[model samples]
Target chain A: MIALVQQDGPLRIEITEGVIEPLPFAIPTFQDESGTAGAIADEISRVIAADLSGTGLFREIPSTSFISSVTNFSAPVAYPDWKAVNAQALITGAVTESGGQITVKFRVYDVFSGAELGQGIQIVGTTAGIRRIAHKVADTVYSRITGETGYFDSRVVFVSETGPKNARSKRLAVMDYDGANVTYLTDSQSLVLAPRFSGSGDRLLYTSYETGQPQIYVMDVGTAERRALGTGGGNMAFSPRFTPDGQGLIFSLEQGGNSDIYRMDLQGGGLQQLTNSPAIETAPSFSPDGTQIVFESDRSGSQQLYIMGAGGGEPQRISFGPGRYGTPVWSPRGDLIAFTKQNEGRFHIGVMRTDGSEERLLTASFLDEGPTWAPNGRVIMFTRESQGSDGAAGLYSVDISGRNLRRVPTPDSASDPSWGPLQN
Target chain B: MKKITIAVMLVSALALTACSKNRFNGQDGTAGAGTIQPGSANDPSSPAYFNQTIGDRVLFAVDQSTLSAEAQSVLTQQATWLSNNPAYSAIVEGHADEQGTREYNVALGARRASAVQSFLIERGVAPNRLKTVSYGKERPLAVCSEESCYAQNRRAVTVLTSAAGS
Candidate 1:
């Protein structure tokens, strides 16, 4: 329950309580000499409005309801006109084009308090960059008001699927986390299962069936060039994951009909077998310190989770609950392990402490698994498949508290989401 | 409870048919037929006591690396069969539901196969004769959008590459 009251000098402010209503804001159209430029300004404002309003965190006042027009972009905003419409905040901008470059200048005002919040200017390569420029402006305003970092600039990498159920085609696609700027990194002809970002978000490691067998491949995000890491033989190799340091890869290799967990140096040519058992052991994720690995195994006649030292000692079973657990990924924070749990025909995405205690089921549905941590470790993004006439798989994000479940937008069906480390 | 009963019945039917198929296949010299004596456990008439096919797999719930009681029973039967035919070596391939992250699913698959291996060892089957690997949702016998298909995909399969009586 925070409220802002304006004062003079550097837009001084004070907070109050009692009314926690949304801070009213007005975004007037940016003045432009050309109609196209005006249209671009209008669209940018619309995107900003959409982004802010969708969060359920802001209230936008309509210009039609305004008492006065913002005709002069450079002139001081008539605070009374904005206050008359009950808009606590006012945003004004102008678009200017020179030598094939577009520049947008914008300012924020606290209308009721009659003070300016901030002002910014952005130059873009083309009019297309206008939207992103607007996004940056909106992010600045929102952060100033809410006191939190904005996610508008981040991107998401997921597996985009098509074709029928039996022979689905998958490719790696990356876009703004909000589903804009969709770009496919790999051609859809190959079957790409999971695409996980390296620590730097500049590269990706994923499983591809391009060679008719599941093999791990690493691709540069910028160049889209891929190189096979391990020399995959007749045996299938799948589920390649990067060590926290990004210097080694942990993956499952099927040799002589047996699948075992192996770690290989990303640069050097040494493969180390991490687990040697008759039971299937795969999906190894390193602890933050790279000292222990948490993975799923069926060593106890059921598929349960186990943790062991990175050097391949005996594993201690961590899951003792009512159902089977799989896909244990260590959180980047090193406090919990996220996994998928199946019980009584329902699949769940859950997290438990590193020792397998304090298991909390974050989501439950017909089919939900694959929990990847947000770069900040506050939220998890996973794929949820609904069962019905329109049974489809899509990417979904949920707070670790099991609240704020929201669908991440994608052009087609998406799954196996891997949240990259925060962008630089 | 009703669903569980039906599932039990279905499992029984599948086990009976699987056992008959194993006998027929063994007689055909896919592998020499070795008598699979039911170990001391539950009722002999129960499907759990029947000798299961050596090279078969059991489905798991999505993301579940834990073996169900049904899966444990199947592995027990497999262990008895393996011990009786000591020359045979097996590879357990673990898999996961397609709904998961693939790397984690591979680990989950490995857990599933390892669960079977430990169960076989507890039942007197030598651990050295068995090997485990995880497919992690890479291979699918049934490809559909339905839960049934996903359940079948999440599994650990014991593949007998060598004949038991060789």
Candidate 2:
């Protein structure tokens, strides 16, 4: 039955099932004789190779398999030697330490084309920044080839869950975009949900039931202090998100009995209602330009996504495919909106153009929702919860092309992820 | 049958009173009291008796916001009991079945609580006497992954506080 159902889903299945050529590349360890600088350099190369190889976009040639030493940064042409090992691309770099600071320089060459694709130099405060430097180099190479920004330097904020399912304790946690350096941002005993980063990655807006009511609160990511926004008495307010400009917030406010979308100034007072309909309107996200917004509402009787002007204009329905859609987050590029769709008893994380055309569901499982774009918009991170016994939720990231599915390490079960922009 | 009729009459009266916005103005000013325990006022064998005890929480299907008929019946009985005890102002805690996104589930939980709140109001309970909060899927009543457990986790719970007591 599942096979029969899969046969009818979409046209991409046929294209995805076909054989395709994998990009072959070679990464040589940095030549730095002795000590921590050399060790860090080698690890950086390894991580960069792993990041690229894991994307399924590149096939890395083992260092042991290489026919050439690539040790000298100023070495002459060795295209023939690289080609002998079936390498299409070659990356070589070196590391140096001076004045208690480290500098790493790397270069990418298209062995097949016999031309340098890109080169980069990074200076780090400590050995730990070597990995970040490596990531930046990888981003540079990736963007040069794909014509899209890389997402490796960003971070994600999500709800970390522990304890029994019925009485789970949840805290807001943040981690590097590649799922390293996990840190807890809030220690509230009450539940925290739907965290979103300001464009600067310094402040976050999320909903907390700490006061016995669901209210929107903004917290400094570094200080952990928070202040409530708006005055809606005790009515429910949730799904808080910041405007791209960081000057305002868009969220859902439940008043009287109806839930509607509203936007308020981040610094203070007055509230402006965006959607005055009787339908449940929540999960509002702003476009990169801040002139438009995308959110999920049940105005059509079932939860679907809609896009509208930032100032509350006519909204155009963007989701028409099977199942219900919710949690629509606009990409920082302003070109796509990532959302969660529930269809045929299964959930999926998908992205569609701003107008909702060409919808592509990236990951499908018992449950997958709350997709937040990596700062550069090349990847999406979302929570995937398994079903039945042993059921648990964890963070997962996939390229926008629907490749490189990998689990992000978290201290506990995580959900409702929101990715912050690249650190300055 | 006699007991069922009496319970239905009480529910109808409460539902009627809920529709009027100012219905709480004439009641014992202590309508906000929150100390009424569930299942304490009826025969122990009666379904309504569960209202006086810590009532069981209802579970929901994945990504669903609508209450099942059984859950609605539970809420109806809860509303009827709240009407009978005027001193008990209750908070409806909405919860999800653990199958959707946290934010959406929070919203879904709210919709569930709102659905129950509107139902109770339509059945004549005062709006001020009832408040709603959504826990999304954060607070579950059951921990298992089976349908039996999931059903119990998706629920709108009536938490009676001391504020309603006169």
Candidate 3:
């Protein structure tokens, strides 16, 4: 039965399972409304186009292909000109600079229907945060066009590596989702690994080896002040992750020569042992709702994935595959879990349901591990080390559908990336 | 025949010099691995001597930590030396081959070190004299990807330190 599709508005494009043709969109360089706007207008427009094109769902028509240009920000778009060029969607924006602050406003139109999708909104921020303002605008347009949350406005906390493999140095680094505006949080005096951001992205949790042994530490990303998590009690702790609400942390602690998972209340200083087995248990990630946790354990004599209650109880094994699985991260959308699997001399990044069914491998290489999700759950970034003795580690991201695989730019080798939530 | 005799005499003279020089100074052209100093009984450097000559590390099979007969023999020698020199304490650093995940390798390394520690204790070494730490695959003695290098990396090393009165 063919159902008549109703167009909710000009921006609503119905997506179905079939051969999908790329949508053509156009964004003329944004106009400068004030003399002080300088080159920000053009830079912001280019960034927005790049962001949209990176998704692989839309193709940006070069400005040379446009029949007309948007010289004024407030003027209505000439729909006939865009329709003539076969451009289905068009975005127009203006930039103004005043005092030490900059403001940007943009509008999106469905040229085919000749209707405005939404009213133009203005974003104001400090001149230093112009890129952030641009990202915010692009996120707005992306959400409106695709009807999905945008991940471009998020950040990633990862381990920046340098030097040789035997004596490598690692520091915690943060950057924009597109690998821009990088800032190092640690001085590399100690080895850092597996940095995870809080729900609000105000703080970070990672494992550091400052005291001659791996220990968990939490730091305020803005202030750079840090403190050891929980009382060390003469034990080693590592593989840390924040709880869903950011009020607690789940990590692996080695005591008496055995490793197990534990949960700690950050606000109340309460500690609870989640798993009490002689076998190894580590890499615990909370479900989006904070009711369940999916982690890796070796109780069955080989590494495998398992799920248990947040408060801790009997854990039912989720992975029964042929190879070992580790570093399981639940998707923000609460539909799938991403993990690193080692099988037949090769490592791969894979995803599976909460019940461990319909497993799909996204990437395969000599060594690919530590998969983290984008804010929108559409992409995953992981550590891929080359083969042989001279191999180096670097960060790579792939769309969840296994397309658009790209290397994230970094000055040195990088690993253990944890993408943060979208900035408010 | 005269030239051959002279050549053998020159070679014998050079070998004699090398042997006398090594016997007096304990120095050789080759360095690293098995560079030991000849000493008397109950030498003040006995702990270092044991570490350098008797071997302080034992290798393990791929992912298994079960002690091999050769590894057990080394541990037996270590136990005897530790009992003879009670003032020295040992730290067993467990390490794993870079063939598995980081977290699992760490656990596997810890198990290997614990195996060494248990064997030492069972052989009459004081439990308090031994401490265990798992470096996982972080610290590798050999930096290669082949099995020969991996065999060297998957080992537990016993590092001895002087505890003075203890």
Q: DockQ of each model against the real complex?
A: 0.10, 0.17, 0.12
- What would the DockQ be for model 3? 0.12
Error of 1 at A376 (Å): 4.0
Residue lDDT tens for model 2, B122-151 = 887888887888887777666776678777
A21, model 1: CA deviation in Å? 6.4
lDDT of 2 by residue, A1-424 (tens): 0001121222011113334355677888876733557777788788788777765566788878878787687676498888899777678887777655777777777676677765455545556566677777777766665555666666788889886555567788777766777778766466678788899998899887666677888887776667878647788888888888788888888875468888888875668899988777888888888888898888897889998998998999999998899889888877889999998788999999998899998888988888988886767888898776557888898867677788988878988788887665
lDDT of each: 0.70, 0.73, 0.81
Query: Which model is ahead, 1 or 3, in terms of DockQ?
Result: 3
TM values, all candidates: 0.68, 0.82, 0.88
2 or 3, which is superior by DockQ?
2
Task: Tell me the spans in candidate 2 whose CA falls farther than 4 Å from its real position.
Answer: A1-20, A33-36, A119-122, B1-87, B118-129, B143-147, B164-166
- How much of the true A–B contact set does each candidate keep? 0.17, 0.35, 0.22
Q: List clashing residue pairs in candidate 3.
A: none
Name the top lDDT candidate. Answer: 3
TM-score of chain B of 3: 0.72
lDDT of 1 by residue, A339-424 (tens): 98988778899999998898989898988978888764556889887664345679998756665578888989899888876454
Error of 1 at B91 (Å): 12
Worst 10 residues of 1 chain A by lDDT: A8-17
Which rank order by lDDT, best down to worst? 3, 2, 1
